[model samples]
Target chain A: MKDHEAVIVGVADAPLINGKVAQPGSALQIVARCAKAALDEAGLTLGDVDGLFTAGMWGIPGVGQLPTVTLSEFLGIRPVVHDGTNIGGSAFEAHLGHAALAIEQGLCDVALIVYGSAQRSEMSRNLAGRPATLTMQFETPWGLPTPVGGYALAAMRHMHEYGTTREHLAEIAVAARAWAGLNPAATKRDPITVDDVLAAPTISKPLGLLDCCLVTDGGGAIVVTRASHAKAQGLKPIHVRGHGQAATHWTIAAMPDLARLTAAEMASERAFAMAGVTHDAIDLVEVYDSFTITTLLTLEALGFAERGGGGEFVSNGRIAPGGAFPLNTNGGGLSYAHPGMYGIFLLIEAVRQMRGEVEPERQIANVRTALVHGTGGTLSSGATCILSLD
Target chain B: MTKPHPVVDPGTAPYWAALKEKRLILKSCRACGQAHFYPREICPHCYSDDLDWIEAKGTGEIYSYTVAVRPAGQAFEADAPYTIAIVTLDEGPRMMTRIVAADADAVEIGKKVTVRFVEEDDLVLPFFALGGA
Candidate 1:
């Protein structure tokens, strides 16, 4: 292993509510538990952590402003490097790339990336219009739905131009539910069908209730260090092969194209190029599923399917469990849990799948390479990371 | 609950003030010869401060839209199932507004639309109706 190569030696999620360790607590408390577990898995302690990366919507005015400082103070470890980048849900995936560069540059030795949210527990998530301030003034005053409406616009455009149907979108939800059925931690695992998706109440036109991700209380963490250091610690090192991140626009109106995810295309191209691997070489895939359209557009953006070909590609159970392609094995945010920011959980599940730590039913056999991509905002930002068990 | 209204600031004060007189205006960048919505002091296209206001045709085609079957919030419960749309103006810039139609089916992509001003409290919000000019 290269001495300067960054490797992830530890990954963990906060106490699971439905799966295990159902400890009810604040967002901070949940992250503390998750961080402890990840560090313990790495055979390290807070004293050894010199770098900290964290992001969230939990403590906006006070804790969120200085998220890393709050976490460092609570964890009782002061490090030379710290980053608190909140680019919506993709912030954690972006953190993974930032942490890798920091580790490679010798900025810090032990890096910890963590996120926690209690939106569900606190009932903080509501179908409310964003305040008509700043860039949102043009949107909120029109009573445009916060997020679903933006995605619906994309879906409508995709359908109008590419002959995609609501049924095609339902296939993604059906596939996610099938995967969730095999996941013990999945929030909704009743095994829904395409009809169920179509029958669900429409939150916004073209996007039903089932089309949206679950709003659950959850937290996750990851520990990264040099590959050489990981070997010295007697832990298996999952190499950070490549990572890339990009943002197109904050508001949906400003998005360059309603039918395409330009940020994801840009982000994955850089990541795939840096990793020196093709899409066919990837053994497993995990992507942010904030909405069903999110997964579909990301699949196209990631090159799994041709542009305007995602609807046909995702049809016929291609990405379902026991299907041709393995995707969102942990049920994704759609069926698993989305506590506001879902990127951290994507990394956690990717690391687990690579380490073969997931339930046998959902585990992909012999995963040598995994690609995890996170989409944040209203299809406004994207971050991609490639992990290899080399 | 009252619906959300735009908070006018110095940079956007002129645009909002013009709306009171039912005049639709946009910030036209002299440097880049481009027009943009939600007025700004500097040109977004050229990053130049040499910007001026120009009256817009306020006619465009629906680039995309969503009918909010569910209200955005409590304030919009009465207005559920309203169509929110991005209309590409004839002047070549897109803006977010509501598309008011006699029937919901009248809203669709490529449908020609013209701007309509509605007085809400102290603000006049620009919405669109299904028609050209």
Candidate 2:
């Protein structure tokens, strides 16, 4: 097989809470558990794996063990490409691209992309204290603590620039909760109404309680397969029609347009080009919902709706089950789980949709082509992958 | 030491110190024509070593903003229901700061805002109140 033709034959996840994981940051315990689950789901053992990629932990202080090295020692598997990146959740997709490149280069056969964080767990060292690296050292000294504040700033700007309302943002949380009602695994499965979303507490002003995500302890993983090998091995093959990634801005202030993410647009364009399908061809979307605003922005950027119209589209129930473009079927970061690298969860849910394995009530019909988006670092990084089944 | 030590590192001491003086500053990259807040050692764009800190004009538009109803972390307990906004400075860069003087309904996008300092956690935070006020 030539380069860039690798497929994703197996996928799985640990879970998420408020777009965060439950591990105690770099526990190594969560990563191991999620990786094992993914390998098992793929019908492959640790010995069958030859590559690894992991990301999104302020957990480890300063350890140099990549998953391929550490897991080989822990799970006892060895491979050439060992990637441990921290670009927020989008790093997993970046890892998949690298794994695809490795397979295309004949560097490795099976690449395991893994991410887990105990973000919500106790004994978590980083949230209170600053990590060795943070995009906010200079800015936060003005007192920017966590990423919620960073995005809150953007949410405010979106409201000021467009006529985006608090009610509009509420629609996102309401819709996600509506979807989560059917998904037992989602953290907030109580079935919240828009009024409930509006009345809920506020995390940052303009972004309410429902606007923010849960920060829980969990992990997620995916197995990128070589298309040729999967066909011969009789594994369910999901074609990665196209892939696109862009990380041009270094800081939130550096963005050309903070109200909208240009990177999501660039990624979706490239992914659609590779998939050989237009937005009209996509039956379901699994966009990262780190916040309600993220979904609204990505939806507009992906052309699912017009800019500033995401709130209306979401309010109309277009993205809910039986809608034109069902999203984050596994309850998303709001209802299902966020566990940090939400991108991994997006991939996992998309694969399940394509495989026709999604629970009947939650499944979006005719899911031949799907859009999976991952965001990293407070919308600082982004990746888009288009997948389809033959 | 009390809680929230906020150990001022080598790269960010100046900006924090200036904020203590009720003065706002930003890092301008000579290599690329971009003004960036949250100063890093290198340019966020070009990664050039050529970077310098300059005082901001203290006037910017509320690019976007929101008020917090819930307190986050220990640092903001007293500041719940306070305004947090991203202000697009006159220099063409956006900076995050809290908003004061205006209630949520009074705040609008593209509204003019000005910088003021709020002392908390042994750090003087830059916040924006309604500009004309």
Candidate 3:
């Protein structure tokens, strides 16, 4: 690796008791705890951090305006390099790329990317808090549930055009639960069959409760530095091979195509080109699973399956544990802790898999390369990263 | 609980006003000759500020839809299981709106639809119904 090549040195998730934040949980407190733990694992202190990156839906109205400033003041570390790019859930994946660019350009040597959310504890996970303003004014007044309704609409279109079924969508949830059964940190571990998924109360038509992600409180952080620095410190580094992020539109109606995730296609194409890797070379895959349709669309858009073929691609235990493909191995947002924005958890799991740090049964064997993707908003934004242990 | 009311601004005022008059209007770009929704002064199609408002036929097709078995919040509890849909208007721009039908099965992709006006307090909202309804 080049001397200034960026590599991840440490990663950690904030403490969770039964997948919920232990009381006294605030977004700031959780983020700070994760930041400190990640730094400590890297054998560095807050003083060593020259770059700080964060994105979240916390301290609403204020942090929405000045997230970097809020985090800097609370963490008590003022950095010359800081970024607060909030493009919804995938913000941290974008931040990782930004941090890598800063490191390679010598703008900063050490970068800390962090995120935290107490959406469950605060009881703010629903659409109740949203106001009818701007683009939302058109959607909210109609009683359309934010996010979930948006995804269901996409599911309806996909089914109409390609003959996708609730059974095909249920496979995704079953796969996630199977993985969750092996993960102690996962919020839901009970084995669920496709029939169970279909039988669950429908949140929105075409999407049952099992088709949605779990809501909890959680935080995560990643520490990045040059490969040369990590080598000198005798740390095993996970190379940040490539990253790309893109967005089409914020509202579901404005999406260029309801059946396809155009942003994921753009983001993953760039990431794969940069990494010089093919789809077959990837040992593991982790993508945002805010909903089952999100995962189905992402699989097709990422080129693992042909457009409209995700239903066939993920069928019959294809992505479950000991299956042909390993996906969302941390149980994913479907069965893992969702805590509102779920992009940060994707990175955390990818890094752990690369380092062989996960529980024995859950770890994939001979895993050398991994791909992580995050989808944010109502199928709005996509950010992809390719990481390697080589 | 009352459902949310659209927060209107100068750019969207005319569209809402037309709805109050029981007519649907769309901003059509004179340059590209393509129409758009949510009423923007600048045409998203060709970046032309030359735009005109035209009366929509109020007839469309259900591009996609979802029945909110659990409503958004208390404001919509009474309307639980209401159908939320995206209708591809005859003018070509797709819009987010409610699909009002006595039977949930009446709503489906590709179904012909037409708009109806519902007045709530000071506001008039546009909702769709199956053409057969």
Candidate 4:
């Protein structure tokens, strides 16, 4: 590795659910706290952060004005690099990649990546008044509404040809919940069985309540710096060896295929090739769980399992702790608070696992490398990053 | 006539208007002779600005398909189990539309279909159904 490969040395995640932390904070406050914690974990102060990377085009559009601006003002330091990407949820991974390239060029020593949102409230408010949810406002008129509905439509097609079933989809959620049970900060910690998931309330046909992810207001962050800088500062650096992104079509309606996420598959292929690792070589996996079927389908797309065999591979307690593979150990978006920012959480969990600070039981043994994937906007955009310890 | 049903953007107004009134429209480059749908101003195949809207025979085959077993969002809960297919039009462009005369069970890849307009808000949307049916 070069002296300045973008390396994530330290990471800190704000507790997802309300507990010992201060009660009732907005998404901005959550972002500030998480950013603060990430810097602190690196044994650095706010003043040490030279660059700030923000995700999603939202919460603010005009330059020099971001919710990050308020946080920056509170710290009394202007950032040299302010990157705000609006690719739905894939912005963080994209930001991290961009940050890495910038760090290689001596842009900044410490890059702060943070995101938080009140998607639960925003979605509810929009649905109560608007004819369609904001996500589905355009396609819903043509009868494509909600992420689950869109994905369920795709999953149903998979079932038609590949015989994938609700049980197969449920197995993904069940495995996620089992991993969540071992997490202290998970919003839904109790274990769930495939049968329990299948019997859960139906949000959409074949995709019951359990198949969908949670929606809550929360934030998470990861701090990156040149490897040598972090090493000179006495922090262990997780090398950014692999990163790539792919998008098939802007709208789901125009895509040539539905049963598989071709973009995610392509992105993962690029990432693994960049990282020089195979599916079996990866010790930890963090597949985005916007919906249960997403995980199942992504597992297959990422080559973790064969086509239509995700259900077979994930069933029978195979993905939980002590199982074949450890996935979404931070509870994922399903059990973890989704907070409208899934990419940030995936990197955060990967960092925590690699740092070896997670609660012991939830921690996967001998995790030298991790694969973190993110999906944005009805699987319209996707990117994957491989974080490895050398 | 001006395009109706909200496909009236500067780039695609002509295409949507052509799709209406029973015309399958595609952007045919006068210089390149390429045909495509969900029309864009520049040809993805040749990047040409010289293009015209040409009427199609409204015949195509299913490239791929999905069944919406779960009705999601607020507007689609009533339309559960609808078949949405990405049909490869005879003009060589693929479009997303609901396929009629084919149930969730009957839909298959490469199945022939023909464009049929469905009216919404005084707007005619080009839908499709089994070609023989």
Off by over 4 Å in 4: A1-3, A18-22, A57-76, A121-140, A201-205, B1-7, B29-34, B61-85, B99-113, B130-133
Better of 2 and 4 by DockQ: 2
lDDT of 2 by residue, A242-344 (tens): 7888875655655667678788888888888877889778888888888888888888888888876776777767677667667888878877776555678
State chain A's TM-score for model 3. Answer: 0.98
Q: All candidates' lDDT scores? A: 0.89, 0.72, 0.90, 0.72
Worst 10 residues of 2 chain A by lDDT: A123-132
lDDT string for model 1 (B21-107, tens) is 998999999989999986877887889999999999889999998889998888889888888889899988889888875646878
Docking quality category of candidate 2 according to DockQ thresholds: acceptable
Pick the lDDT winner.
Answer: 3
Listing candidates in order, what is each one's chain A TM-score?
Answer: 0.98, 0.90, 0.98, 0.90
Two-way lDDT contest, 3 vs 4, winner: 3
- Considering only N, C-alpha and C atoms within 3 Å, which residue pairs clash in candidate 4? A57-A86
Better-scoring candidate (DockQ), 1 or 2? 1
Q: What is the overall TM-score of model 4 with all chains considered together?
A: 0.86
| Candidate 3: regions farther than 4 A off | none
TM-score of each: 0.98, 0.87, 0.98, 0.86
lDDT of 3 by residue, A235-284 (tens): 88998888999999987889989999999999999999999999988999
